[model samples]
Target chain A: MKRMKKALERVAETGFFLCAAAAVLALALIVVFLVAKGVPAASKIGLWPFISGTVWQPSAEKFGIAPMIAASLLSTLGAAVAGGLIGLACALLLAEVAPRALAGMMRPLIHLLAGIPSVVYGFFGLMAVVPLITQWFGGTGNSLLAVIVILSAMILPTMVSLAETALRAVPAAYREGSLALGATKMQTMLRVTLPAAKSGVLNAFVLSTGRAIGETMAVILVAGNRAALPSSILDPVRPLTANIALELSYASGLHEEALYLTGVVLLLFIVGINIASHLALRGGKGGR
Target chain B: MRKILDALGYILLWLCGALSIAFLAVILIYVLSRGIPGVNWQFLSTVYKPGLGLTGIRQIIWGTLGIAGLTLAIAVPVGVFAAIYMAEYAKRGRVLTAIRFCVESLAGIPSILYGLFGYTFFVMQCAFGFSLLSSALTLAIMVLPVIIRATEEALFTVPVSYREGSLALGAGKLTTLMRVVLPSAVPGILSAIILSMGRVMGETAAVYYTAGTMAKAPQTVFSSTRSLAVHLYLLVKEGLGAGEAFATATVLIVIIVGLNALASWIARRMSQRFTGGAKT
Candidate 1:
């Protein structure tokens, strides 16, 4: 009976181990497959002209991903900067100033915003924001500016939640010490609290950057699918995700592979950002 | 001077909150106004036609449900088990640390990259041939991190005393986890499902590659089908049909909102029940 019970226990333990191992293996397989498929494409294209050239013409067999890369970077940077500042301010407000009731109400609403579908945002941008832009700016409804606005709105919830969490993590003693030295609430928030929470705030920004750079549907609808660099914010421009989504269906042979190469570039960029943020947090912990 | 700064800070914070609320309101209003009037029983029941009147989104709806369900089925057990391993079984070691890093890294990778990976591997090599199964598998991969994190959190919240008591009564570890820990963690697991559902519903890029855009419902697991998100994208992009897209968008929004509310309510109810049980 004892031996039987021990055998049963071992079976359960092995089953649990296999379950965990399978999940990790699945993730590893994805990364390996992406690299294997993307590398040959990158090698054939010589990497430079494929990523740096501005024109993408499948008919002519010429493909350059420069515009998409630029648009992605520009819009992502815009959203991160704009959303990061607003998020930090909101976090400070929630942490320091708002009454408990108000904060409680605001917290879930913010989460709901985060939970809303990106496609819904696309619909909103198409009907309301696009018209507003076209009427005022005298350009096409779909442009880099439209992408920026929608992406910023999409990223706002993430920024707010992360910043709020970080701000709350700041020790109460720091605030009290600053107050004892005759610092006002606003002054303490700006000098002592903000400084203490800087790494966390920075982490939030990095996370938002990842969101913006990879955003697809919202940006795709607003970005106009043009393969040229934007002369102005209102000019139609394509990004990596949009290009892939638009062309993935019919793209054959080299063109399809090149598209995968674009994915590799994007994956590398995001992985680099993740690694950097992890290192920064680790360093911050060690320093403390 | 300090008074003015403090006032400004308060105003800015309120304004930010207002802006977030206003954005949600604007979206809901626009989607409903444009979409709701066009929604009819016929529109919800028929397959899409390119040139004819606005056909139903029934096929896409089914496709969406099929893919989302498959993703949930694939993701939930794996994620929960992995989380249990991480929280309860794994020792603090280099391997565990590496797994933690990988999980976080996976979470941060963009949906677009996932699409790229899916297309290259699943569509091209795995020869799944751009079917619902491929898309479902990709989505399962995409949501793994969210599920693992949520499950770990839920497991962590299970009181240590409960486990101790169960063990003292001679309940084996597996029995304790299956009978006690899992029931207590139901709400957390549900929240993860809700979150993953939202992601799957909204996803366009990832599905676009692995699941080719077919107007009809998939005939089988191997058949191609369009999800509501992919359908919406095609409608808007190709300028094929406007009213149907709006109607579909409205339905999508309603479903997403309903799921979100249900998730929150379940979480609250579960916690309340746990508290009530603890008191006894």
Candidate 2:
């Protein structure tokens, strides 16, 4: 019986280890497959031209991603700035001001916001926000600005939740000390709590930007998907994510490979963002 | 001046909070108001009409469930066992760090990249082709981090004393884990499963390429299928049916909200149980 139990333990341990190893294996597979598919195409196109060339007409065999890259960076910057500020303010309200009951009631709304599928957001954006843009700003309704608005709204929940956690984590002593120094409540929050939670909030902002950068369906629906350089925020542009989703269905040969290369670029951006967010998190821990 | 600025500051905070809430309310109210009117029994129960994009969503619903169910089947056991390994068995060291890093990296990855990987690896390389099996396999990998994190957290909260007591009473480690640890972690695992289901159901880009946008009911796991989210995307993108699009959007929102609420409720209940148990 003891030997049987020992054998069983050994079997369970091996099985559990394989399960854990599966995660590492999955990540490794994703990186390997993406690079293997994407790199040869990158080399053929000459890495610089593929990244910085002017046009992206896949049918004509031209594959440039500069415009898409610019669109992604600009829209994410806009959305992150807009979403991050509003989200930070909302976090402050939730953490420092609102009654516990009200905050509790409000959280589900944020979760709902987060939970709603991007396609639904895209549909809503197309039906509602696009029309408003056309009526007011007078473009094809689908433009970079519409992408920013939709993405900012899409990213709000993530920003608010992360920032709120950071704000709540600020030691109460900081606020108390500021109040004891005769600072007003507003002044204390602004000067004491906000500063103390700065790294965490920054972490939240970086992560939200990553989300904005990665978002695909909603951006595709609203951004008009014109793969070209844009002179203004009102101009329609296709981001890198949109580039892959829009074309990968029918694309074959080198064009398909180019799309995989697009995914590689996107993965690199995500990795960079993750590293930055991780560092920001570590910075918060070090400060504390 | 200081007093006035302070008043403004208070107003700003309230305004921002109100604004965030308003965004949620607007999206919900807008989709429901526009969509609820268009939905009918025929739309919900009958097979979808291809190309027309107007008649029904019975197939889409089934496809969504199939993908989500299969994904959970693939993900949950592997995730739970992985969490068990990390929480109950594994020691602190480089293996733990490597696993943690991979999990975090996976979590941060965008879905479209997963879609790309799914297309290249599952569809082309593995020859699963564009089908339910491909999408499920892709999404299973995508949601592993979520399940592992939640399950590990739940395992951590199972109370060391319970394990100690079982072992002291001569229960073997494997037996204690299976009989004692898992029972308490069910709520967390359930919540995690529900969360991943919601994610898989809502996923569009990753599923779209892996599971081709065929409007017919999926005949088997090997058959190409379009999920509800992807169906909605096609409806809007192709300008197929505006009213139906709205209706589909509403259905998706309703289900997603329900799932999110359920997960949160389970999470709340689990936390309460653990805290209460600790007190006793």
- Against the native complex, each candidate's DockQ, computed on alpha carbons, is 0.63, 0.90
Q: What is candidate 2's lDDT per residue for A1-288, written digit by digit as tens?
A: 899999999999999999999999999999999999999899889899999987999989999999999999999999998888999999998999999999988877887899999999898999899999999999798999999999989889999999999899898999999999999999999999999999989999999999899999999999999989989999999999999999998999899899999999999999999989989989878976
Give the RMSD in angstroms, all C-alphas superposed, for model 2. Answer: 1.4
CA lDDT, every model vs. true structure: 0.82, 0.92
- How far is B210's C-alpha from truth in model 2 (Å)? 0.6
Per-model TM-score, in order, reads: 0.94, 0.98
Best of the candidates, DockQ: 2
Residue B272 displacement in candidate 1 (angstroms): 4.3
Docking class of 1: medium
Worst 10-residue lDDT window for candidate 2 chain A reads: A104-113
Local lDDT at A23 for model 1: 66
* Residue B123's lDDT in candidate 2: 92
